[model samples]
Target: VNTHGNTDFRNLFSQLIQKPEEDLELDRAALYLAGEEYPEVDVLSHLAQLDAFAAQVSQRVTHETAPANLARAIADYLFGELGFDGNSGRYYSPENSFLNRVLETRTGIPITLSLLFLEVARRLGVRCSGVGLPGHFIVGLDDTGEYLDPFNAGAPLSMEDCRALVDRMSAGSLEWTDQFLEPYTKRDILFRILNNLKAVYMQGREYTKAVGVIQRMSIISPGLPSLYQEQAWCHAEQQEFRLAIGTLEAYLQEAGTPDDSKEVKDQIKGLWSTLSRLN
Candidate 1:
């Protein structure tokens, strides 16, 4: 496929990947990724919108000193007043993956909603982290260990609430583990968001956008071998044979002796034969 030159995305990825993994800002980096889908979006302007929202939330939080109370206040403001809620009908919609659209529509899937909650909490001096709880993402404060499912009108979630979500996501075949409560690192959060965006694109057969998403995912977290293979697949689907061949080669370097490596090796050989025929 013909490459879509995205200089702004290139610069954003370069700047983000260079930062120490721990210090990478999940909120801002994710905004940039959403900005990729909307070339004309002014990311800084949306940031200002977040700042303004947080400031308004800060006003209602004056008398609420406890963490849980503050969290409830913020949730009431966001979900109750602002009308933010999960988009249950269209789970895989690309618009659900874009922050700008989420702001306008006040609807999104778990991760995007979680991201907005995380950012607002951080700005308001609330202690919170992103929980990549299996198939659904949630937010938790530092002190209370209390969870909030942002997708569900910022509803407070007990362990039972979490278990129910896990069961539903797994079709009642899986149970909750302690892993469900663990907070995701910033890099982890950003990577998952990109993965969500890529999945939506792939489902729509939008290979160009999927490739671009994986390209960003690869840069942000270079050690993920699966991303290289994904990039290769997208390139192959687009008939960018040479680029596909190169990406598959890169994936094999990271594959080692895994069972999947042999399959990838066969793919590379087939791609090479196709390349020769084209020549």
Candidate 2:
């Protein structure tokens, strides 16, 4: 009896750890991944341990300690005692993966972790809020109302640092905007999660699931032109020409004048022409 439970938990953890970050459909995936089996001990017990550790660290932090110092202390606790492997530099969390696994299960992880280090800046108490940034989820510490990223692992960064990180992640081709730095609501965070899922589905050639994710995103962020474009592409791939045309048109209406706009219009016109042929 114990063997079956142990095997179930192992399988669940394996699937979760192995699932690509982009493809995580929290509700559906979590159900499927966690459904197979669980031990008498709750799976979230691991997360609870992290929460307890964070609470202990949070208590020791003060307005006098520098953010960097606090970060180092917490990192040591996490890596040394808690068994989290701090990749080579001891700076960032697990290299390319966003910290969602810790974040999703431990809702307070981001805010608590950020608070533990925010003791450095004396000007004001920093309030931590989660921002679902494109390609990543980050914590924003409101320092006397100024939003700053704490996920850089205690390193103090200017707005330029944020842009540089985006550029690095985008392989230097994309430009960052002021919009990227603006604070996002919890609703925006959920959409970001869905968008991430869409990317994974598209990559895996799971067009239906990609479309479903994009559709959900559109409900939350109806004004985002790129979401419509993605939906159009998904529909086109499935040969749903009329739906694709409608989606492309909607994107064109929202997308303003630019080289990208011209290119998009050309693509839309071509898609429409293709649809006409099919009709």
**What TM-score would candidate 2 get against the native?**
0.47
Error of 1 at 5 (Å): 5.6
Candidate 2 lDDT score relative to the true structure: 0.50
Q: What is the lDDT of residue 244 in candidate 1?
A: 90
lDDT of 1 at 66: 87
RMSD list, candidates in order: 2.3, 11.2
Candidate 2's residue-wise lDDT over 1-279, tens digit each?
A: 011123453344445434554453232333222232222434355334445666766676776866545554564554344544323342222211223343333212233233322322211233445544445444455543233344434444566666777788688877778777676553444455455556656877777656756655654556676777788788889887777777777676766554467777788788889978978
Off by over 4 Å in 1: 1-5, 252-263
Q: Which 10 residues in a row give candidate 1 its minimum summed lDDT?
A: 1-10
Q: After superposition, how far is residue 232 of candidate 1 from its true place, in Å?
A: 1.3
Which pairs in model 1 have colliding backbones? none
Q: How far does residue 55 in candidate 2 sit from its true spot (Å)?
A: 3.2
lDDT tens readout by residue for model 1, 190-227? 78888898898998999988988888777777747788
- Score every model by TM-score: 0.91, 0.47
